[model samples]
Target: MNKPLAERLRPAKLEDYLSQQHLVGPNGSLQQALKVGIIPSLILWGPPGIGKTTLASIISKESNRPFYTLSAINSGVKDVREVIDKAKQSGGLFTQKNPILFIDEIHRFSKSQQDSLLGAVEKGWVTLIGATTENPSFEVIPALLSRCQVYILKPFSKEDLIKLLRRAISEDDIINKKSVTLKETEALLRLSGGDARKLLNIFELVVTTESTTSVEITNEMVLSKVQQNTVLYDKTGDQHYDIISAFIKSIRGSDPNGAVYWLARMIEGGEDVKFIARRLIISASEDIGNANPTALVIANNCFQAVTTIGYPESRIILSQCVTYLASSAKSNASYKAIGKAQQLVKQTGDLPVPLNLRNAPTQLMKEIGYGETYKYAHDYKGNFVEEEFLPDEIKGTTFYSPGESARETTIRKELKNKWGLKYNY
Candidate 1:
């Protein structure tokens, strides 16, 4: 009932903040930034509980700046504006830096919500710090992302977790009063899933499960307490990705029941609607490509629809998309073709276009034999011609092979008719 052990032991200063040495070490960029008196807007991207929030707090405290925090999970444009307005009022009083506006799980914020922060960050009304577990490149809008510095926080190293366990037992007022001995930590660390806060929470739970004055933590003790009290849907942890993977795989495997079940799990967990819609889009292309070309259209429209209509209604839209994709015929031919094409490109860098295939837009290009011998497919019989389209070196290459699905079968037949054995269709 008292403050959780993780909260009780949260570091108040940078020196006390554990790990992330690359960012906070003596030779680190952030350390130098604080020393040199320049604090740019930042995006802290990483897994759960590696001191992202704590570090943000330490930065605000060290600089003596007014700090405002927002969770993109629940906060909206109105909430962001209200916080920015308060920061702007107090920003003038502080000369060292603007008031800090820190948003946790910032990847959950929509385009408009993120746009609301742009003006404040641009005019220096507040210094924006956004934390995200997902890759900011995919989740954050480019305009807002461009204005911030991105620092990746890795999961705590084994050594760092050990240091944290030792520190908690020795330093925390509530934990220390219990006088627990961390005799073994392999299970404790494992159950924590490389999360610092998880490690401490599990440690606290293992020791404090009983009212005994002295506690001994072992692998069995850690597991016993944890299995009894572990949360099922930790939205910020591994379960989030696991359930989404299940949902995508279910759709790909054409199991509407499984797909909808996982979709419900994500929806019930308060997963971001855009995140679900975006994944559905990728699944449509990657798994349901050409076999059912219309799948992508539905997924795209689903993304657009969910973006306009959020939450409860968005869940309905997602359900319809999920079930439709699950029932659609699946194919990966187009996806594989592009992947093979990219690999070939990387292997042969900047292969020159064949002269006949090159566009002769200017007289000089035409004089250089560009388009000189090119066969205009339109002018040819059946609107097709058997000419070398690829560069001379890889002329006979077949990067795209139709899958065994019906649509791709038709595509293969058409190519076979046109190119004979050239396409290996």
Candidate 2:
């Protein structure tokens, strides 16, 4: 059997691994854990071709544990139990050397399928190492998620990808048998989109097909050999991220036509409805915000509606929400305000709340004058009162600057009327 370059070059040991130095470096927590022969249940979350599966295999080998594999794409609840039973028999229950069960694309597993894993993992029957390209918080059930430590694997850096190409050239038996020099890598790197597996596959494709014994790689040659454009949407690949970004940017730019076009692309590609709805909700809040609070309400309703109603019918609801958000007046004041406030908090390091802001539930607290100077806003004119609401050290610090949209203009006027430049409105 002929093995692909990616599989042929899979690192069997930690020393041979590339990229993710943060997770596999000397002072890294994961590396430290492996040093002591303590392997905890962990979820490797990141993009495709980033060595999640290879790392799992390395962990199992380094720990000297029985290894089992499953793909959430095909496996079911019954398949999970069968594997758990086999692992239990092989390693015994709650033993120090428990089996390692690696599940790929774990996000595809339904709630019931994930539920079946709860007992075995909790009891230490198998040390679970699941891999996902999606956010585990949204896919993994809370019960199962809480049991595993989530370690994120980042996309391969430019330096790391170059290192992979060099290693493959110098180490691989088939490639080294011929003379090959990497003169340029811009086309290869751009085509791979920071995916190590894709890089290796492209590199191998470019190298092995050369007719001459001596081969020199260049950007032009790489592009000539491989198709430069793709019309099909790969929901799991780079297109997935790129399209979603285009979709949200269109909404933020207030281009309803562009928003609907990207929405149609995703829909035609059979993209997950829940994923589309989630992005709409985020865009409504982060982009539209108080300029049209109704945008958020509509986006949230769209999520619930699409979740309950799957594809073919849910597309209509999504189009409605997308167009509404794209046409709405935009404001990022709330988003920017929170960002500035968070930076201030980090700089200030948790200043104490003002005395009046503290609760005076107990008489003992009341004796200390917790609410002595606290004014009741309703007791004053216009149902408002002026008081120091911020910490003494950070008083009069303004964070919110309302946007110039119609709704926010009204808000700015109201603030100017009430505080009289106290907030510099």
Candidate 3:
């Protein structure tokens, strides 16, 4: 069998693992766990090729515990249950130290899938080590998340990448047989985007593709070799964020063509259908707020439809919603209003509500002036009454300014008429 350079060069021990010193150093967070052989359930969150899997393997090896690996990309609840059952039998049944179960891309697991692991984790049937590139707080269930210690992994620095390249040349038998000198690394590092496995694998490709023993790797040579291999959509790398950025920008810019094109890119790339729909829903509110109130309704409906009907069919519903959002009038008035309100609340902490605005459920509360001088709009003409709504301290503040659109222009006119000089914008 032919093994890739990344797999071949996988570090086996903690001392051999590079970078992530905060998690594994002698004075690191896991120092006691590794030394005393008491492993806790942990969640390792970071960008790809940063040694989450390698660190888990090293911890297992150092602690002399059986290691079970599962990739969330291919594994489901059944696979998780089978592994946990086997782990329970292995050591968790008769010992305090449970076998370590390492799960990669753990963020992809659904709520039910995560719920299934709760019993085993709580009972010490397994010491779980979950790895994810996404933020675990949002992806992992609160119950599951609370049970594990989440440690963030940083990307490898230029100095670390250089060390890895030299180490590969010195250690790997294939590369050691060839005369591969790291003459220039700027192109290699830039293309790899701080991913250690990508950095090493790209270096290997540059060396092996040369077909000659004496090859001095240069920036120009590395770029030429890696240009064709660069992809536009990698869920684990920069392309994932970049493409989504473009998708949102297109919708916000009101370019239906661009929006649909990027949507197709995400759909073709097998992105989580729910993930795409969720972004669309946010964009609708943040980018197209009250300018066209129906946009939010449509975006919400699209989200529900896509969640219920996934894949090839969901693409049509998403495309429809994207075009509608792109064609609608844009405004961030609601988005801005909420932000300003939050800032004001922070500045004026727990300011007392006006007597008119306070609710009085009891006679004593009403006697103390709660609900005093409150106007009933129905008793006034046009069901409108001008009254003190804000606190006396900041009574004349204006937070919600209507955007310039046919719909909001009408709303602004109505407000000015109702408040007279108070809303005389």
Each candidate: RMSD: 3.0, 2.6, 3.9
Give the least accurate 10-residue stretch of model 2, judged by summed lDDT: 228-237
CA lDDT of each candidate?
A: 0.87, 0.90, 0.87
Instruction: Tell me the RMSD of model 2 versus the true structure.
Output: 2.6
Question: Which pairs clash inside model 2?
Answer: none
Identify the candidate with maximal TM-score. 2
Q: Lowest-scoring 10 consecutive residues by lDDT in candidate 3?
A: 231-240
RMSD of 3: 3.9
What would the per-residue lDDT of candidate 3 be over residues 1-425, giving only the tens digit for each residue?
65878898999878888988887888888876777777889999998789999899888888888899998889899999999989988885536568999999898888889998999898888999999988898789999999999999988899999999999899998888898888898988887778888787788888888978998989999888877666621444445667789999999999999999989888877787777888889999999888999999999999999878888899999999999999889988889889988898899888889987889999998999888889999999999999988777777777888899898888889999998778434
Candidate 1: misplaced stretches above 4 Å?
Answer: 16-22, 74-78, 93-95, 110-112, 134-143, 155-163, 176-193, 210-221, 231-238
Candidate 1 clash pair list: none
For candidate 3, what is the lDDT?
0.87
Ranking by TM-score: 2, 1, 3
Q: Tell me the TM-score of each prediction against the true structure.
A: 0.87, 0.90, 0.81
- Candidate 2 wrongly placed segments (more than 4 Å): 228-235, 267-272
TM-score of 1: 0.87
